[model samples]
Every structure is written in structure tokens, then in C-alpha cells.
Target: MTSPLANPLNRRLLGASALALVLSASGQAFAQTTPQTDETDDATTQLSLGKIVVSAGVEKIATDTPQAVTVLNQDDIDDTQASTIGDLLDDVPGVYTAGGASNLGQTFNIRGMTSNRGEVLMLVDGVENYFEGYRMGAFFSEPELYKRVEVLRGPSSSTLYGSGALAGVINFTTKDASDFLTGDDRFALRTRFGYESNGDGKLGSIIMATRPTEDVDLLIALNGRTSDDYEDGNGDVVTPSDASANSVLAKARYYIGGDRKHSVWASAQVWESDSYQLYDQITGFTAFGTVRRRTRDEAFAVGYDNSFEGNDLLDLKAQVSVSETLTDQDGIALASSLGYASEYSYSTVQARLENTSKFTLSPDWTAFVTAGLQYYSQERRNPRYKADGSPLSNGATTHPEGDTTRYGGFVQAEILWRDKLVITPGLRIDHTELSPGAGVVVGGGSTAVPEDATNTGYSPKLAVLYNLTDYLNVFGSVAHTERMPILDEVYSRSGTAPVNLNLDPEKSDNYELGASLTLRGLATSSDRLNAKLTAFNNTVENLITSASATSGYFINVGEAKYEGFEVEAEYATRSLFARASYATVDATNETTGVLLNTRPADELNLNLGYVLNSLDLTVGWRGEFVSGITNYNATTGAVSSTVDSYNVHDLYATWRPRSGSLAGMDVRVSVDNVLDDYVKNNLASFAGQGRSFKLSLGKTF
Candidate 1:
């Protein structure tokens, strides 16, 4: 299907159709808000939820995994300028980034997996975390309310999760009462003022509080940010500056009796927002913005877990959520006769239960067994009709509305030997059934195609971790996974379907090895100084893409693979310290022999900190670079070219003075896009943020 960005009436909203040729790859924007620390800094390395308690798959695991996963803790995110997961993802290697501050329908590509037909899968506490539509891009989600981010790179991930995970999985784990389990009542408040280069003004805030009652614990978090349109490096106001979002997260947990051995945990959250697309009202618009392009969303969930006798583990979790999102210019038209239009929405409800046990299987080994089941229901609507009488909704046909039901079960086993070797093998099987589209039957007047497809798939993974020395550990892993097309692909009435659903599900296999090393003993005396590095090759078959066909749908293309390497290291010292990490990814189409159109090949991160007398100072820098790309036409070999390579650098500094009477107060200054790089890093359609600075004061109690 043609992109709304290509529509002449909507062209002004984005740049020119020519740039669309370039930005298809979701680009990454990574900046450093905190400085690196030396090994000496280890003496005071604070261990909190940010450092551990990672939620990667269908369950929570330690950050120390056999795969390439990056854990961004709450404290790090708290101090960073990034307001959402999209902002923080810019620094993670092998991950392509895109969308400005508020591009709801945008998607991210990890490895060589990206397209109008999405391949990436994102989850919030094991839920779909998607817009109403199956083909809808990443649902608009605010990051300030989250506890951490877990990104799994490459296919072969199924061991627990199934399809829609071809390239990777991004799990936005929310904060809970357990995360704030400090001894006393605590509260922290932060507020900031922002100014866009294109000329918009706004304010942002982050608030958190925890209270412990007689037998219960409560935690609360709040964050809000708003801004105006911004100009490019050349002084061009890319879009309207009006953007706003508000979110609240709360959790309550109670202890049984007084032993604290048996406790129950529950949590809930609400997120809502209305934003303006930063673009010319007249030039580029899919639909006019009389009412402004807007969307709304919300979610709620609760669960319980307890540790019992015999080292056995039992857990039960149930959650349900409803979300609605829409984008259109119903009352407002960018072009008079050429006025454009479109609307999309996603709503979902889900729940699941999981159990695991650790028991002695032999004299020399122990075993871990896990089992789980999940259910989901989602509805999507996309109307591509125009303001004036038009024959089609999205360049061709109108999208049908329907809901899909998905259910699945999984089990895994892990065994350890001699306290030096560990092996884990896991499997998951899924069954998905699409609720028939009774609204418009397929083959009706040839305007719509009726498709009710249901299929089952399997996911398996095997990994080995071995301790080679007292200070180092090495590991290797291989896994097979799959990705089933979303409801949008089988039934996108928008006529964007380049191919039809007869296409097979996408599948993948990954091979990798890496190591974790502890170096404080050899380096300058410090409590903890560690480093990790990994390299791998992952290839996918039948990669899905919009194609040219009679039944317009998605289908597997020639083989595509992503080969890359990553290195992330941190050192803390008593007086001063620094930390840095980088990744180089070569995502390419093996059939066409070109770099994956949307992914970058290089990234860099560095941070430094100093503590003197009663004051602490820090300097941080992050740089992201990318090569160019190639776009193709099914009928032709090479159709067009995209953005060239670009690099961005940022700096940040903050001071916390000794506070005897002040209790808790601090000031900070940050310079984003420090060089004012003017390159249009619009991953594909949306514009990018430019050089801007922020200053603020905050307090904690």
C-alpha cells in the first residue's frame, strides 16, 4: 500500500516523497544523560530494581542472560533526558530507531526485520501491548511510567514467546511495589522546562512516592510532558509544536500474618495523550487536522507470587486492558479538493498463569521446570475513505474491522552441573484463531476478501553457560522461533496489501556466543567493574513484505539476515569512574546483497563522573552512526535510495551539592544534539529532533 506520506495532500506533513525513499528504517537516537564510572566507583554502586530483576520473556529473569539483552534501570532512566522507550532505544545497538516524540503508528526494526508489514513484537508484562489493529504499528506508549526495558535481538527467541518476534522483542516492564521496597516512606519529585528549536514551549514532570501501612505497601508514579513543533537544522518547523501526555501508575501489596513468607502483589496504571503531527497543514497530510490528530489509551493488571517449602515456586497472574487510538483531520483539511483522511484503532484484553519448580534430580545436578498458558483478544479498525466522495479508503480499498483470539502454552527445563556449567532448553506452542469477519464477507463485489486463518507453531531454545575462571564466564546458544502475520495482513481493507495471506509464517534460527568478565581485581581497586561482549549471525526465511499481487497481502521474501557484534562495559571507582558500550550491525538482504534498508551499522556510548567534597559532577556523551540503504520493487531490482550515513553527539552535566539542611535538592543542565546536526534522521516518514538544551532543579525526600 502507498504510504500516506506519499500523498500530495499529506506530503507537507512529512518532507517530500523523495525523502520517503530514505527514512523507511526506524533510526536510533541515543544520548548520554549520565557519566561513566571507573572501577573505583564500584565502592558505592547502588543495587536497585534498575540493576536487577529483569523481565525479558514470558517471565522475569536476571539481566545475566546468554543473549544480547540490554537492561535500562529506573535510576538511569530517571536521570536521563529520554522521556520514553523510543528515546532510550536510540543507544541500544542492533536496534533501529524511528519516529519523532509522538509518531503513534510508527514501528521499530531489529536486525534486518522491518517494513510496512511489521516484524518486531513488543510486550508489556506479557500482553500484546499493541494498537487496536493487527497491522497497526507500535501502539503509542509513554515510558516515564515503566520500570525497565528488555530488548532481545534476532529471531530464534521462541523458547517462550512465539511469532511477531522475528527480529526481536521489546518488553516494557512497569514499576511495582516490590521495586520500591525500601525500609521507610520515600518520595521524589522532578520537573523540567523545554524549548524546541522550531519554537515550542513546554514543561515536564516525574513524581514518585512510596508508603508502607500497618500490613501493606503502596507505590505511586506520575509523569507528564508537552512541547511545540520544532524546526530542522535549516530552521524549518517540521510539525506543530503541540504534544502532551499524562500517565499514572500505582501498586499495593499486603503481607500475610507476619512472617512475610506468604505475600500478595497487585498493580494498576492509566495512560492518556493527545498530540499534533509536526508538519505543514497544507503540504503533507493524509487527512486535514481540524480537530488535530489524537489518540487515547489505558491498561490494568494484578498478580500474586510466593516462595514455599521444598524450594518450590508457584505464581498466578491475571490482567485485562482496553486501549483506543485514532489519527485523522476530519474537520480540518490540508488541501481543499485534495483533502485526505484515515482512522485506525486497537483494543485488547489478556490474562495468563505460570508455574515453575526447582528440585534435585541427581547427586551432581539440579533441575528447573516451567509451564504457562495465555489468552488474548484484539479488535482493529482502519477507514481510509477521504473527506470528499472517494472510491477507496487507503489508496485502494477500505480496511475491514474484526477481532482475533489467541491462546498458547509453554514449558521449559534447566539443568546445572558441578556449579560451573548450566544448560537450559525450552519450548512453547501457540494456537491462534481469527474471529471470522462477518461484517464484510470476502470476494464480495471484489471490494473485500474474507479470510479466517488459524494456525499453530512451536518455539524451542537451548543455551549453555560455563565458568572458565574465577572472574569470567562464557556462553553459547541457539534457538528457533516464528512470526505469524497479524490480523492486519490477512485482512487489510486499505488495499495496502502487496501480497495475500496464502503466504507462510516467517521463521528464524540464531547462533551466538559471548562472555562476561569481572575485572576489579586486576584494574584499579574497586568493588565491581565488569564487561560483556557478544557476536552472532541470525537469518530469517520468508520475510514478510507488502508486495504486488491480486489479493494484496504480505508474503515471505528472499532470505534476509543480520550479522553483528556488541560490547558494553562499565567500571566504577572510589573517586571517579566511566562506562561505555558500542555495537556494529550489518543487516542485509542475502538475496539482493544490500544493507537492510532501515538499520544502522554503528553506535557509541560514553559517560564520566566525579565526586568532590560535598558536590558531585558528571559529563556524558553518546554517538550513533549509520550507513545508507537500498529500496526495491517486486517488479524491479532497485527502485530507490534512502538517507546517507549520519552521526549525532550529545552531552549532559549535573551537580548535587552537600545537603545537611537542604535534605534533598539538585540542579542539572543538558545539551541534546550538541553539534546541531542538521541531517534529516527521519527513520522513514516522521521528522527528527534537533539541537536543544534543558536546565532544571529537583528535590527528593
Candidate 2:
């Protein structure tokens, strides 16, 4: 008889478990046994306006940072009742989702730049999530698995995050055992079940956490979901949209050294999905048939963090991670006994190390410096198979079997003057090399030799913030960023072999100005108001764009420009809260004097909520609006289409008992698209979901 772990999938799980054990053992051997104080606890206890560690320079309070940043806590995540990444980001200003309904093709558009070609960088716990190939998606993880999400807008992030962040960065921080074991309990368990009417979706999740000792903690979670095809506003079923997904996550942490100054952690997550998409048959081609698609994604990471007790100069953090995404497509011709299959795989491995130091320049002035190094590599491969499970001799992969390697180093400094003024400056340099494999075939049925290219980039950023009063601050920033061409842009084949090996790196100059105000006791003794306004101008040179619709090659567009403004405000009291945000962008191709394709339209979001503490009940309402947008023709550079503007509304309520037989239990209900309004996204090809209701129940012990 064989053990259950003997199976391949179980073996992988056991391997991840063993790796966590090894990390724990190593931390215990190198660290001194002492009671550890969790830094996250201290951070959580601070007011919302306190220091933020996700900024460009050293950690600083929100009022001191010169960029537009948004932080969403767990409570915000729960209130939205989101089923996909797009749903989760709908309310964020200056950001838009491009794909329709499916998780496999979704991408983000930030400011006037988009991630369709990997302009925006996605990070999970400081580890890079690489996207490659045409059908690839962003890092999609279960919302319940995260504690918070931080979005940094603009190109200044290049100094800290390196390449692929020409637009900005989105970072996700996962939950830990301490998040669930809030009290003195040694063990805790949480279970959740939810349903959505639009897709007839049902979901179940379980989380378990344990603190075996004062210095060790462990957490494990599993989630599963299944959904059917959903209906549009017109009461028509969205074809081939059914799906089933599952995710597994495990994390471990060990605290070592005196006063818990040293810490080590390891985390592993695996997500898999099976879904179908409709492919209409060609008018004259009998072999064309509907296709079925399946996708699987997995990510794993390990990290170490340490802080010195007696010294303020040597805090260290390091991480290494690897991720892979695989997609398979099968097509069967309904009119004949014919079938075909193809597979695509993308993978990445990355590592990072950083050290931070702080010094007291004077009684009222302090300074900090951060320096880091990063390295990563990515590879993509595609293979085609015949209906009889045999290989096609003439078949060729898309984008080539190539890999990209990047190495970078950066340093940033933050200085305070008289505790009323702050200045931040940073610089980064990166070297990248792209190597393609041999035996590649071009579109014209000719073999092309592989080519290698190397490029370098320099990024510089400076920002300043001045406190005008106790409740008001003004800030400004200017930065220069450069992006090297990605694999697909340079290696994608055209007729016979027109490889672009001499393409120059795209360059951008960005400028921003913003202000923030925090007012306490605005109307009542406990009322608070926070507001922010920001404006930006960005110009890009040597923009890489496709040459023509018929040509697969890429060329450098002369220039492009993006200008935008954003406004956000929130007012909160003991029992009531209200918030609103608006963003507008004007983007154009400078050389052609025409609007960019699929440019994001003006957006507005508003929310209001009230809590009845006495009854343990809460109710809220949310609204979103997007203006009409114009689309441009790729070859003719003319207006080809327009998407009409639309509006959506949602309502939600929650009941949780603080102290009773139902204590530690919560029930939530929501109605989305309350009016059953017909709506279409500015960039998506399909219509948005119609009126729907959601219900969720959860309990913790």
C-alpha cells in the first residue's frame, strides 16, 4: 500500500511543507531565543495617518510622501464583495480594467499607461509577478488571502522596483497567523461560505492558524469556487463563461534573536482553474470550430527580515521567489471528426535584497537611507499538437522561446528639516539582456536565426513636501524613467525575419503636484475629514508601437503625452462615513495628433455607510460612473469606434454579533447593479454583468 502523499500533487505539497521546515530550522540555529514583538502589531495600532512603509523613499507618514498612494485594508476588501481583480479595483481612481469577465485575460490601465505590454509591475509580498505572452493575466489571488493592497501611481517606482514598472506598482500583502489569533489563544479556525446570483457562483473557504510556541507561527488556507454562465443586461447568456477554481496557501514564520530582532518566513500558494470560451466558426473554413480553454497558475516564495535592537543602521530584508503559468487550448470541429490542441507556458524566478538605515541629524530632524539590489529572469514557450496527438512539423511558437535577464541596483534617501519639510531623492541603474533560442520560424514560412540584445537604463527621482499648517501639506515630484523592450515587442516575427534588435529603450519624464489635508473634529467631537488632490503630466519618447495591422514588427513612435488629475475625500464619524473619488485623463499620440487607442475615460466613485453599534449592523451604498471613450484605428490612425458612457450602483448590509450566542459570526448581503442597467466597459469586448445579489456567512473560533 502506498501513502497518500505518494501522488504527484501531494508530493508537491509535501515538498513545500519540507521547505518551510528547513527555513524554520535554519532561523532557530542562527537566532537567539527571545520573546519577539511583532512590528505589524505596532503598525496596526497606529492611526491611519501614521507612517507608511510602501513609499519610494524610506518609510514616512502619508502626508510626507510626494506621490499618489492608496491603501485598502481588509475591511475595505470585505465591503466591496468582489469576485475578480477587476471588481476589486473598480473604485480606485486613475485605474481601469481592460479584459471582459474572465480572469485569464485581465490587465490594468493606470494613468494613461496600460499593462497590456507589461508596463505595470505586480508584486506579491515584495516578490515580482511576471507576465509574459499575449494570453497572460495579472497576478490573481483570492481576496481573502490578503491583508491589504497598496497602489503607487506614476513612474517614480523605477528607483525602487526596477524594470517593468514604467507606469507604477501594485503590491499585495498576505495575512498571517497573528491576523487570526488576535487574542491569547494558541489556535484558531475560520470558515466562510458565499454565493453570487449573476453567475450562480458558490464558494467555500477554510483557514487554520496555530502558534505552537512564542516564537513560531503557522497558517494554512484552502478555497474553492464554481460558477455557471452569467447573463447580460439584455438577459442573454454570456457564452462559454462557466468556470471552477481552487487555491491552496501555506505560510510559516519563526522569530529569533533577542527581543525578536530577527525573523524568517516562507509562503507557498497554488491556484488552478478550468474554463471555456466560445470561438465562432469562419464563414468559409469548415475546420474552424469552437474551442475550450484551461489555465493553471502557481507561485512560491521565501523571505527573511531582521531589525537591530541597539543599532538604527542595519535593518535587512531579503526574498526569493518563483512562479509559473500554463495555458492549454483544445479545439474540436463539430462538423467533422477533427481536433487540435496547443499549450503555452510562462515562468519567472526573482530575488531581492535591501538594507535600511536611520540617523538622527538633530533633536527635531531625522534622515534615512535605503539601498537594494534585484535580479530576475523570465521564459516563455508554446507548442502545437495535431488531432491525433502528434506534433506538426511546420508549427512554430509565438514570441519565440526566449528569456530576459535583468540586474539592477538602487539607493534612495529621505531627509527632514525642522520636522516641517521633507525631501526625497533616489537613483537606479539596470542592465538587461535578451537571448532568443534557435530554430524560430517567421510568419512567411522561413526559418530565422535568433538574435541577442543588451540595453541599459538610468532612473532618477526627486520629491519635496512642506507642511504649511498643522492640518495641511503640499508636495511635488519630478522623475525620469526608461523602459527596455520586452520579449514579444522585439522578437515577434514578421514576414521572413524583421527582428528589431536595435530598438532603443523608451524614455519618459514625469511631473506631479499634490496636496493633502487632515481635519479632526470637523463637525462632531469624534468626526475626521481627509482630502487629497493631485495633478500630473507625463511625456514619453521613442514609444514602441506596432508598425501596421498586417505587419507583426514593432516601430518607435515619435512621442506620446499623458495628463491627468485626481481628487479624493473621506469623512468619517463614530457611526457614519462617506467618501468620493474622481479621476480624468487626456492622452494622445503626439506625432499623429490623435487620441490613443482605448484611452481611459473620466471616472467617478462615491460611497456612503452607517454603522449601528448597538445592534451590530451596518449598511452602505456605492456608485461608479465612466464617461464615453473613443477608439483609434491601428493602421490608419483614425477614429474607428466609440464606447458609450455608463453608470452602476450597489447596496450592501452586514450583521455581526459582538457578544452573544452568535458571537464571532458575521452575515452579509449585497445587490450589485441595482437598476439592472445595461453597461459596457471602455476597453472590454463583452457587456458587463446585469443585476445580481450576493450573500456571505463566516465564523471564527
TM-score of each: 0.82, 0.88
Per-residue CA lDDT of candidate 2, range 1-701, in tens?
12332233453344344334433433443322222112243212212333264745665555456887777776667766677767777888888877546554467889867776667777778777766544444455667777777778888787899754667887888888888886568999999899999989888989999999888889999988888888877788875556678888899999996476689999998878877654321111223534676777788888999887678999999999888888787774541222277676778898999998998988888888899999988877766668777864222433466778999999988888885798889899989998875445444344656568899998999988987766667999999988889877777665644657777889989999987765554455545555667788999899898663233466687988898777776656668877777777778889988888746777777788888879989898998766666778755787788767777889999998999789989899999989887777766656778899999999998
Candidate 2: residue pairs that collide: 32-257
> What is candidate 1's lDDT per residue for 167-199, written digit by digit as tens?
667777877655544565553344433333334
Candidate 1: minimum summed lDDT over ten consecutive residues — where?
A: 24-33
Off by over 4 Å in 2: 1-57, 278-290, 332-339, 393-398, 441-448, 548-552
TM-score of 2: 0.88
Best by TM-score: 2
Q: Could you tell me the lDDT of residue 115 within candidate 1?
A: 27
lDDT against true structure, model 2: 0.73
Error of 1 at 331 (Å): 5.2
Question: Each candidate: what lDDT?
Answer: 0.57, 0.73
